[model samples]
Target: MMAPEDAALNGHETDKISVLIIDDDSQVCRFLSKIFTGMGYSVSHELTLTQGISHIFSGRVDILFLDVNLPDGNGLEAINTIRHHPSPPEIIVITADDNVDGAEIAMKSKAWDYIAKTGSSKNFRFALERAVEYRRQKKASLSRNDIRREGIVGESRGILKCLEKVAVAAHSDIPVLVTGETGTGKELFSRAIHACSPRCSEPFVVVDCAALPEHLVESTIFGHTRGAFTGADRDRTGLMKIADRGTLFLDEVGELPLEIQKKFLRAIQEKKFRPLGSKTEIHSNFRLICATHRDLEDLIKKEKFREDLFYRIVSLTLHLPPLKDRGEDVAGLALNHMKNQHGANLKNGCIMSRPFMEELQIYDWPGNVRELFNTLDRVCAEAGEGATLFPHHLPEHIRAFNIRHRYAVRQTETPDPETGSFEGPLVPSEPLPPFKDHMEKNKAEYLGHLVAVTQGDIKACCRISGLSRGHLYRLMQQYDIKNNADS
Candidate 1:
């Protein structure tokens, strides 16, 4: 291991600027370290290129101060090595023998600044301060450009409120828990959160906690070395490492075993973990997002889930609204799904008939948006070609459904005490006509009553009958129905 030196803070925590001084001269390294230390900077120094590279790769050293001469190699070449880091530090080439070639090499290597050892202290201070400020500004700009959320569809109060929380959650790097019933698009929410985060470019790893078996859980999540366990023939990287420096989403998080939860808690707390049989630990810096349909609180009470792990993961929470409660968003979602499937090929028109729209609004979507999309897609396919989606095209159960009055009693007849006969709500105006004639007369009366109620609105009448407007008008004329609607 290369040498590592860190100054102890006196219990005071701040975002201290870290500096690495790489020089072969012991006196110069110590002197420069003392100068930065007195300025409230966290300082470390390495006498060799190997030690400097090791320190940088270990995820420390924000700014690097390099010397032209090293025990093992030239410091100018070390610029290429330093800049290769995933998040490289700003470099300042400080050499006693600065020359034209060295300055050109430093600029080509993207060095932040070049300072000669004989340069004044004021010049050195100016370059270091400016480099740190540039780093800060770059980070801020990257975050500002990262937010880009899409795919969510809803404008109801419940969904609008949830979106507000989602926007707030995207700006931070903390664990978020999204709770909702099945088919509520939990995974889509996870993707939206990732797209709107600073780590958007990084991979978005998903772990379906409930789908993995007990035996393969550890191997899949924490990886294994070759011959580390039985049947382990090759090196495998864990999902945690794959998700390093990005988002790790755990769907159905309630299904995680208590034992696995304990192991995960420690790894998450330390940002480090080891393969099943490995000795050295691997560090994974991942933003977490967990989703579950089951109530984790109830699982905790039943001892099925760990309460401690729950608190560790649920730093923020957002709950999605089911489709039944989204009101007009249901119509909007249906239109979107239809347009997506039909594209521009819906030449005969893909509009839903008035009856179909009313039925959709009143029906309780127990299966949520997933079920709604499936039902619509099925109906459209079964409709064949050139036939618009009408209420009659809907599934039998959905088309037949009618919302009953909440307070209306059942239409049961009661016997009167004064007479040994039953009472009916209505009496025939005259003796019933012949059976066939009676049916025709009743149908005409009902059609006239429908026209009256709808105030001659042909579209409204067709919606009530689940029939075409032309059919309703023909029936009205055949029945000799005459009302103010004709005027």
Candidate 2:
């Protein structure tokens, strides 16, 4: 028998394609196992129909080489039951009985292919290959649909791991707490969770705790009766009520006031709350999803957030990894963001420079996705009729930070004896780049100075610099030089 790890790494794919053989004859099982195993399939064999059915229901097998005749029972009798399984493996029936009626019966039961044991080995090989190909195509189509339906992008391990948790969370009814830095798409993930859950058809209500005023927090959340307060002229419904039989997403949930935490806790626990100035309490059935960057544990120690409230809200948690930690995902995200032309405010068709994209990967995005998108938006606008975004198109601070970070790294690797004992990062007098890159950098600096001195007067700069309008614009594009405030 192949080791479990070896079996799992079959073929070029990370996940092995599994094949199961159901044959009472030990010699036949051994003969078929060699062929399937040699073809890079994880193979298993059982001697009886019951054992084969048990293996099939375990869901590990992708394709089954089922023998119609078994010692304990006939495999043809259980074909319908196996075919109807939720994740049934494709079946290829093989038997020496050479019974035409049995082949017809297997086909009617949805067996992928039927073969006679007396058939040539070549024909059997072709049948097994077709069965595996069918399984692969089916799995690929389902995987693609799953990726799109999730609305989450990125191939980083962190993102893939988070998505696994999201899928698991969707099956159960529990409070989910999403904790991440601002702009890490907490609300987006929360929406995806709701969309995948059982209550997806119902309303998905959002409550921005940070945006809610302290004075109106109670009335806004629990609602109020007619003439309850100075401005309560009519009866109003609360967000919790609107989210009944659905999901309630509380963004920046940590900003919720401490006084209201107890009331929120009780409402969550009892599923009932009394609106302001209302004589009777109303019931609401809503799934809770909360998101915040704040650490509830630290807040709990300081009494800023109630411990009971924290426990009530955090039945499960998902933390989004910061952009810097995602490695190649930064470049992937930058390109993907540029391709999201429909929702973007900036014009499309502008391209990003290799150097600019490299800098994007190097810099730590403090504001995460939001900051990256904002920078790209400005770059797209400043690019004008130009095709590419260069380092000069970036905000000054980001460019400077990139250069400083690279210089610091270089200095650490090859320290100057004069500055060996440094007080802080030694700022290089000049930016270092290869010969070709340096020439472009020099041209961009000169153009930037000329633009600043001309005060963005393009015609004047063209005349003063003794260059044609076409030539100057071309240089600006080549150097990624942008003079406007948008740059």
Candidate 3:
């Protein structure tokens, strides 16, 4: 390890900047470490990508020097994960292979720099210096503007990264493309962008590309003059026109008609369009924001979308991660939703039992945030005047989904009967139990736990299980299960 010197000598800030180098090559690690240490920055090295990623999440790393090929995995692929860190470090990809394609991939993944091992030491030093400077400026800029998160929730790394992007995008007029799974709140982010932008005081127009009538799509977008069409009994304003001096958010943009893409692209480029039956063009200056759950690239490949339009709208891209990947954000989102929607109904603020939260975290929310909110709504409704929520308050389907997932995991962990080993794939040594019998056993177990948790309050049991009083009694009788409150 090289001794740290005054960073001022290198025109760097006196405060130590942390740098992580993840390269299997010992020589490369040493060389990078010496350079960073000499510049008065603290340096750490890892031999594998996994260790590097773990180190990043565990502490503050201002910059990272990543190798494309490592002992465990390719560093290039882990860029997204690193970039989504709560305080992500600027990545400078250093690879032995001077592959042009690799450089393109690195830059596309938003790496700060991509340098080949064959490059001069001066090149590496220059890259490091620039990355540090850029990060300094970026931090200063971010510290100046706080993003306005209207209805957005969660402080997860993924959400924070997107919010940072939203803050940056709001200061510009460039077109933005927000992509995520359905129910991931694309429009909410768009609205946040608009709300934070200079055009916040102006109208924020929404054009649901998917829901627009096929016949009236063009008329609705570009507007229509009186008598222009059968429904054009009078003059009408288009969404684009209505969005003048503001934002035009095209939700589900992938659903936009292919035939209209060319015209739309032209209007976006020129900021001018002629409504139907109009002889002259009208210019409507509007900031464009588009969102889609579909993969625009795949659509382009399928010839269903225009390549030009895809490039035009995606000047800046923000990807919202699925809820399952957001980790503990699920609990925050649930509690927030409960407070906003059901706080008044309960005398005390609604609280979620630990088991209730665990069940929520385990289930993979396929529908993302929208689905999670809907599930919470149902739970609140079922919970009624209850101040606290339990796993039993969840709908039967969600509860069953979590149970099924746990069962699947357990099945995979089952050891081999003869080998007594869990190393290999699970192969049944005996005939599997009947599906009906297995389900009955699970049902009995669930009901027993529910009764214990609810303490046999029949009314509570009925409310939570969504079962009629008679049904609950019949199940209790069939299973020979007795609770103190049972009639």
Q: Which one wins on TM-score?
A: 3
Q: Give the alpha carbon lDDT tens digit for every residue of 1-487 in model 3.
A: 1112212312344346889999999988998899888987899999999899999999989989999999899889999989889889999999989799999999999999999899899998899999988987787467335677867888898888788778767877888889899998999999999998899999999999999988888989999899997868998888899999999999999998988898999999999999988988989999999999998899988999998898788877888999989967998888777767644444444578899899999988999999998887766655665547777677767877887787677667757688876643466678878766876887798788779989998877787776778998899888878796755
- Summing lDDT over every window of 10 consecutive residues in candidate 1, give the lowest-scoring window: 1-10
lDDT of 1 by residue, 112-182 (tens): 88888888777767888898889767754553344353657777888766665565568778788888989
Better of 2 and 3 by TM-score: 3
Pull out the clashing pairs in model 1. Answer: none
TM-score of 3: 0.67
In the range 1-487, model 2's lDDT, one tens digit per residue, is 2223323333254457788999999888998899888888889999989988888887677888888878888888888888777878989999998788998999888889988888788877899899888887776555434532343668898887667557645767888888899888898888888888899999999999999999898888899999999989999999988899999888988999998888999999988999999999999999999999998888888999988888778777888998877867888778877887565445547777798898898889899988988888877765554346767667867876787787677665644589775453555667767755755676688799989988888876664554568998899888788869434
User: Model 2: what TM-score?
Assistant: 0.64
Models sorted by TM-score, best on top = 3, 2, 1
- Score each candidate by Cα lDDT: 0.78, 0.81, 0.85
C-alpha positional error of residue 24 in candidate 3 after TM-score superposition, expressed in Å: 44
TM-score of each candidate structure, all chains considered together: 0.54, 0.64, 0.67
User: What's the true lDDT of residue 487 in model 3?
Assistant: 55
TM-score of 1: 0.54
